[model samples]
Target: MNVLFLGKIQYALYRLVLAETPEAYLLQTHTLPSDLNFMPTLGNGHLGYTVFGDAIFMNGVYNGAGGNSKRARIPNWLNISAVVCDRFGCATDDDELSTTNDTLYEMDLRDGYFRYRKDYKKLGITLEQRSYPHKYFNRALVYEVVASRHATTARSNAPQFLKLSQHPGIASDAFEFVVLNNGSNAKGDYRVIRGRTQVLEFERFQPQPHEIYILFSQSLEEPLQIEWPTWQMEITHRIIICIDREQSVALKDLQDALELNFQDLHQKHIKRWHDFWDNDFSIRIAGNSLELWQIANAGIFYLASSLPSLTTNQKNEPFDGLSPTGLGRGNLEADYQGHSFWDTEIWMLPVVTQFGYDYAKEVLEYRSRKLEAAKYNAYAKGYKGARYPWESAYTGTEVTNPCCPEVAQQEIHISADISFALQKFFAQSADFDWTCDKAWPIAAEVAEFLVSRAACEELKQVCHFLNVMGPDEDHANVDDNVYTNAMAKIALEFAVWAGGMCGNASTELFEKWQQVSNRLLILRDVDLDYHPQHEGYKLNTEVKQADTILLGYPLRFDKSSTHLNDLKYYANATRESGPAMTWSMFAANYLRTSEDWRADEYFERGYKSYVRPEFKVWSETPIGYEGSANFLTGIGGFLQALIFGYGGLDFYRSGNQTTMENSGVLMPPNVEEVEINYIRYGDSKCRWIYKSHSSFMDCGYRKSGKKFEMLQGNKRTLLATNFNVTHRKGDPPIYINLMN
Candidate 1:
């Protein structure tokens, strides 16, 4: 709500009043360079192709000078963007005209005007014609005139056979034109009327690359006409236009004017800002908890302020942040800017789902809406299911280039991310209808695609096609990435559930999914009591086997492996492999399994160790860390740890029955030094601890058969039970159970 109290980071990022308007503010963040910028040859050439998070990448234009892997040799200018809209705000169909193409459409308002040099009229001719940037902003640029023909009244008879002069030429050539003649060479000749010269100087100028100059002639017959039909937001029209003969115009004053008029864009912007403010306010977590709030607000700010609309109104666009390559650079470099990765579904989705469902809906809606593009892609690739591009844009074309040159290329993991988002949307929101209306069909289609993408490993078992990169891009193009396999199985399972519920499910589709699900393969060895990382992931006596927390922590596919044995092994593997975007998930997985005391050590090692010691920013690359809270989705697990780990509460539903169990933690759970008030749902009584570790659960349930027991972890605690105590053996831990 109140921008000032949002937090320091938000205040810093959200308070930069835009030059276009004061009410509008810009959000800012930065991306790191790849590999510490070790090579001098690195340049901006491929920056546009890197995909950063969910931001769409527009290809970076060639800057005349070539580039390399490290440095981005673009212009030196302050990267500026004005806030478009906020959390509650969106550019609707009414904001821009509907068309198959998404380019900005302009409709000129009546007050349209053109601009040109004032002194050109003094030389018995007007040199060139210029146009204002927009009706609101009086910035001007010159336009070249081509061929012109006019027929005047005989009374005028000024130029029946006009001669053209002083035509401006390009650096090396003169202007070319098509001369018009009468029907019969000598019949009636139409002459050029007021043949004027105009030229556009487009020489490469990096320093003043996009300098906008505005000028108004003091002796003008009519006001320069200009208008944009697409923009619905109000804007300040009054602007200072210079008419002096000076070749260059200073932007210092103009920048000030732009910032002042930023208020004109304020109405649309503030509406969006307030929308996010209205969401569930994050509570203070201990210490200067404002930082946590800052994390959330800053993320929202980045989404709101960074997307500069090339069109009048665009929705759900990604912010380029503070990268030097500008927005046109393809998926962000370092973060793989041009590529659409799984981070959106795993890390970012929950935050949006919890705070901005409308935004979250747009995210899902993007996938659903793009289904056709995905389908066409699959068709082009000779597959039955929609295959998403590893990195994509407006066209839904695949952009993933495999590292290995010899193998056939494929961008295979996107289907799983799509399914995961759909599942998250369903789980978090009361939108079952969405599943029936949109998600299921897409899910079924994706399942169909997965089916076509799989190979029969055995009877009732299918293995995903090999040589596909999994979540970790570092070890790319590997077969049966454990995470990828887990995702596929879950996707197929969800697809089956969705298809069975489809009232008019396509028979062919259903059979295809059934066939695929039947043959889906999982990397598990019953004889060795092990879960292989991949199909052929073997471990020598010297090479230790690693644990994959994804299967148990996130998917819950294997309930029997409640306490995973190989977590330490995987932790070591991740540490040795260096940092990765997926590493946070793995760390959170270890935190989920580790008992109370052990969690603090692993949390620090995984989360804090990698985070920047100064600003606490988490960088996608090891070169620099920018704080991103998308990985904070694991905070939900912290809550779970309190209830299930220490509070000893577990709730499960089957058929018509619901079960709840709990134990008092007495001592709160600590997540990165932020303490959680432990609470449990059982016996209708709330158990809590004040200061001491001793805990008691005052059983509130009066049912005769309900029972209570104390759960002791590394420490022993009292369970003050008022219900009949039931003792059971072979159970791992004590639990207070409530029965109807």
Candidate 2:
């Protein structure tokens, strides 16, 4: 099925017109996917499950070894279906129930949910299946079934109770289910094919319930049924589907588990999602009816969904990292076995850090916690400091698929990318504690590795990183790949700055880093006045996605005419088959330059071919191509095109001061105005608004009593930025500086 399973969400119960929120649109699949597993997905960083909740993948829960190592697909605790019974008899769980197999699959972007409605025209009934991986409850997946019919329609043909049954017949030997005491609950454990133990606990209930009974199944392959004595019912099957990294969670008492209120819990989940889309951490574009708003919202939605909710870690659970597919794929090698790579830091981190503070912190924490493993990897590779793997899974070591040995050995830029991301976060966060405790250590080690890795020509004082692979994975064993060298330079400079800021300053080490970085080869095509992908890289040749152009944007390398030339050169050179993120980077690069027309062209090109029209979810490659779906890398890149490309902002740090510069703001040709509300410094939320020639910016804050304070002044002016941030809507071409 070439169908996409996500898009604008329309509520089945009430069509709400939300003010100041992205207006919801209806997204219908041309045809319902034969397998719900191919539909949209839900994840809370704890686990990722399919839309219908059949296959579930958990973080750090790999079951196998070698290239076959994959996330242990646990027994789905949330998979429950019903046979809507009326005068026509049971009308669900069978195709003949509905005259049309077509299902309306919509997502509630405001509340973070995946919902599909099917009308049984043959049987007088309409069914809505609404499910969400809880945004607040890190381990819970909430599934709702809305079955409705008039009581009069429940004639002699109808049973005494509405039928809502647990999906029967566990076919996989991996699952072992046991109906617990009283049959109201059950305990299920998935035995990893290689004998790993991952458990799932289920809690099923109805909000306005009168009477209910559960049919306990004897074995793993028995159909467990639940029937309620009501013609109309909204049954919510809430499962706390948390699987531990090294062990299984102790099964909770059935009484206490079932006692939880579904209504209250669901309201909390919706509220959290709503808060995310409020004026803070949101984007609005005037005169953009091309579904650009929906795509933007969906991109942010998918990225946020994959991460754990921002809350206290009362359970002290393990948070691995953001995978390429976010919470969309698990137990599948197609999504790279749920392993995190340079994608997290290089592609996704920019957007996450801008909006999600705690989530971005978690991304960095995964690397910090895995520092030992990174160091061990470096040691194994005959280097002096931490060397994060090109592919990292539960072990955090080199889990690079043995099939790609060259990438494992030569993609050394992964280390520098991590360090660069940390500093980027610090620029916006200014969390001295995190800088000292977490960021400093990681940055220091990566800088050390770069120093050891680079070979310098003493006479000319030039440094070359040999036997390296750039982002464009097509080439290998290249020296001083421009992107790699630039990132290494950023990492080294960040280490020097972070050390001084965090009391880890070493005069000798800092000087050495500066010397090496100053000389690192940023190879350029002198004739074309643009960067070459790497040493001996020929111009006008096919390269993979977004390589040399990265220097202009994220790395903030040379901003001279070379940057413009590099943008033009790489745009023609990048292959059509390049990953989905490629065009977005080119778009952002072009948007920042004088040629805004090209930016508009590439902006549409970024997603037109990559996004699945059905759900607006991104694929790693263009449609009809085999690549990861719900591709967060592409989603992140898409957001960058807006946040940086259209918003025209630079958030970076030099020495002790952090700065975010907004210059030459470019609006999409169709957009009259745009407002990007972002989180920066500590928790300050700032808004940048630009339309035509007018712009406004404010770093607003709340004081004691009831006073609200906006930054002293800035109309295309630089405001003295505060480390503690609290944002409110304002104008653009705005500059902010946080002075120590």
lDDT of 1 by residue, 131-208 (tens): 222212212111211111112212122111111112211221111222222122153312111111122211221222
lDDT of each: 0.37, 0.68
TM-score for all models, in order of appearance:
0.52, 0.85
Candidate 2's residue-wise lDDT over 1-740, tens digit each?
A: 32221111222223343223345333456565543434666676665676654566666655444344455556564576555654445655456645357767777677777777777665455666776766665544556666544334444433333455555224433333333333222454322221233331111211111111112112223433445344422333343333333222312212222345555555666777777777437777788555887778778877877877665223536578888987557556677877889999989998888776777888888998888888888888788889988888766777777689899889999999999898888887766787889998999999999999999999998999999999999888998898999999999998998888777647999999999999998887777788888878888889888988888887888778899999988888888888888898888888767776788888888888887665677778876677877889998988888878876767777676677666656676677877777645544666667665555565553222222222324533333432232222344344466544
Per-residue error at 593 for model 1, in Å? 2.8
Clashes found in each candidate (C-alpha, N, C closer than 3 A): 53, 13
Model 1's alpha-carbon lDDT is 0.37
Regions of candidate 2 where Cα sits further than 4 Å from its true position? 1-22, 25-30, 33-38, 86-89, 92-102, 151-159, 162-221, 224-257, 702-734
Candidate no. 2 TM-score: 0.85
User: Model 1 clash tally?
Assistant: 53
Report how far off residue 555 is in candidate 2 (Å): 1.0
